[model samples]
Target chain A: TQLLEQSPQFLSIQEGENLTVYCNSSSVFSSLQWYRQEPGEGPVLLVTVVTGGEVKKLKRLTFQFGDARKDSSLHITAAQPGDTGLYLCAGAGGSEKLVFGKGMKLTVNP
Target chain B: EPEVTQTPSHQVTQMGQEVILRCVPISNHLYFYWYRQILGQKVEFLVSFYNNEISEKSEIFDDQFSVERPDGSNFTLKIRSTKLEDSAMYFCASSVRGGRGTGELFFGEGSRLTVL
Candidate 1:
């Protein structure tokens, strides 16, 4: 079984602060995706990283895939209240199943 | 943007009762999947359906759980006998391709199931 572990399970920061979350795994993945889920709602896709050492940016959020394809990281710059949510990283291999990390709950206070 | 939709946002059933959850995936997508997340737990894959048949399934999908694409637009999951442990939020997802390694999934708002 494949497992993805995320660090900093809970983070509380004031607006304008920056934070980074990490996701690590023992197995290699062909692709990794980041999702943000609000309370009482399903997760919303943030970005998908395919190539090793790839980086993608969406507004204030930046996602990076590790060179070995076994890990990834998400960084938020100048966070705002709207950035508060549960961030999850899912790794996919050849099979259709996606292995997801436990997720990081982030709260940005204004 | 297209999105997956599920009906009866919430359902409550008694143990041993049968329940069916309905989902309408994005119109042009070809692959569909069912996932569940217990309260305070990580999301788990239940099953994946493609070309009108189950392509893959997890150990959690036991004899009581089944999936069907009855028509072009609707996908359904039927639980023959609900158990108290079955209580969770069920999400329906769809992708344009069958390979999760290359495709991104679009998910529904989810159906909350509570088995008493």
Candidate 2:
């Protein structure tokens, strides 16, 4: 089974802090997606990186897909309270199913 | 802002009782999926449906689980007998034709199922 492992399961930081969450896997994936979820809600799509070494930015958030297609990362710059949420990474291979990470719970205090 | 919609935001059922979770995928999307997330756990893929049939399913989708697209817009997941372990947040997702490698899935708000 393909597994996505995320580091720093929980993070708490003050406003304006910059942080990065990592998603790593042993198996290669065709594409990777990043999502942010709030309490009692489903995950909201943030970005999708298909090419290896590709980078995409959404406002203050930057997403990177590893060259090997086995890992990804999400970086937030000058985080605000609104950026606080659970960050998840999902990967899809030849199979139709997508494998999700355990998620990184982020808390930004203003 | 087209998005997937799920019905009965919260459902409470007893063990051995059957429950049906409903979802309305975005119009024009071709692929539909069901995923579940246990408390403090990662989201687990249950099944994937395409062209009115199941294209793929995970081990979590056993005999107790079934999926159906009864109408053009409505997709449902039925659990023959819910167990306490079935309590989780169930999310419905859909994607357009060129979806797989592109990684664009629109998800519903999710249905919280509680089994007692």
Candidate 3:
């Protein structure tokens, strides 16, 4: 079974603080995707990293795929209240179906 | 910009009742999928549909669950009998291509299902 485990399942920080969340797995994947889901909303794709050791950024968010393709991480710089949401990492293997992580709920307090 | 849309934002039904969730994926997209997220849990893949047939499905999608693209625009997921475990936020998504290329899937806001 392919399972993606996320660390720091919940985080609360004041605005402007930086934080990092991680997703790790025992299975290597062909591609990894990061998504941010606001309360009551579906997940929105933040970035997709395909190549091992690949890195991608979107505004204040940076996503990194491990060299082994078995892990990934997301770093947020100077988080704001607007950045509060559930961050999800999903890994795609040989098929289109994605294996999603449990997600980290981040609360950026003002 | 186009987006996927779903109906019945929230539904509450008694256990053993049948329910059908609907979705209209982005036009021109070839692949469709259904996923669910239990409260405070990770999003789980339920099934994937393409070419008017189910391309893939998870163990969670058992005999009681079925998917159909009855028309060019609409996709539906039907649960023959609902259980408490089936209650979750069901999300519909689509991708222009399979996961290998971009691996980007566009998701709808989701329909909340509650079993009483």
Candidate 4:
């Protein structure tokens, strides 16, 4: 099975709508990271959560690490068309290498 | 802000040809990694390097694939024999330290390899 799994392979919502995406894993991780990617570009680091239940806010987005360090969620408050992209969640497992999930493609309409 | 840079931006080659994708990671970063994404596939980790040696590698990084830090600055991934399956976008990333604790990987715009 894929070490990391992201929910809602694709999401589309109107501007100013709130939405949430998820990343899940059966195994524990030292940390989990969230990234955004555009076509032909690499994933850009958005946020990283190390502590269980940790929450961080970036502008209009909120990220939360799971209580068991096995999952994470990203919530956008009033998402904009500019927020549209591929959202990926990566888990840092043993050996300090990261395992990535099939990202969710998010589109925010006008 | 400083960023990772890779080149050539895109490369097209025939099967069995050798191809080297080079990356200059964030200068201050100590850990480097290579990841790839086939069209429509998830980003997959290929390998990680630290202290001039491979720290870890995924199953996809096999005998035909290798990485090197030939100079203090340039880190590269070379495919000894490029197969059609190797066609994908390869990304190079680096972090301040091992795993960066929180895995803050700074990635470069990927190098697209098209094997014909």
Highest TM-score among the candidates is held by which one?
A: 1
DockQ winner among the candidates? 3
By lDDT, is 2 or 3 better?
3
Candidate 4 at A88: error in angstroms? Answer: 0.4
Judge the docking of candidate 3 as incorrect, acceptable, medium or high.
high
- lDDT digits (tens) for residues B90-109 of candidate 3: 99999998675577899999
Candidate number 2, chain A TM-score? 0.98
In Å, residue B104's CA in model 3 sits off its true spot by 1.1
Q: Candidate 1 lDDT, tens digit per residue, B21-114? A: 9999999999999999999999999999998899999999999999999889999999999999999999999999755647588889999999
The two-chain DockQ for each candidate, comma-separated, is 0.72, 0.73, 0.82, 0.73
Better of 1 and 3 by TM-score: 1
lDDT of all predictions: 0.93, 0.93, 0.94, 0.93
In candidate 3, residue B78 scores what lDDT? 97
Clashes of 4: 0
**Off by more than 4 A, model 2:** none
Better of 1 and 4 by DockQ: 4
Residues A40-104 of candidate 3 have per-residue lDDT tens digits of 99999889999999998888989999999999999999999999999999999988689999999
Provide i-RMS per model in Å. Answer: 1.2, 1.5, 1.0, 1.5
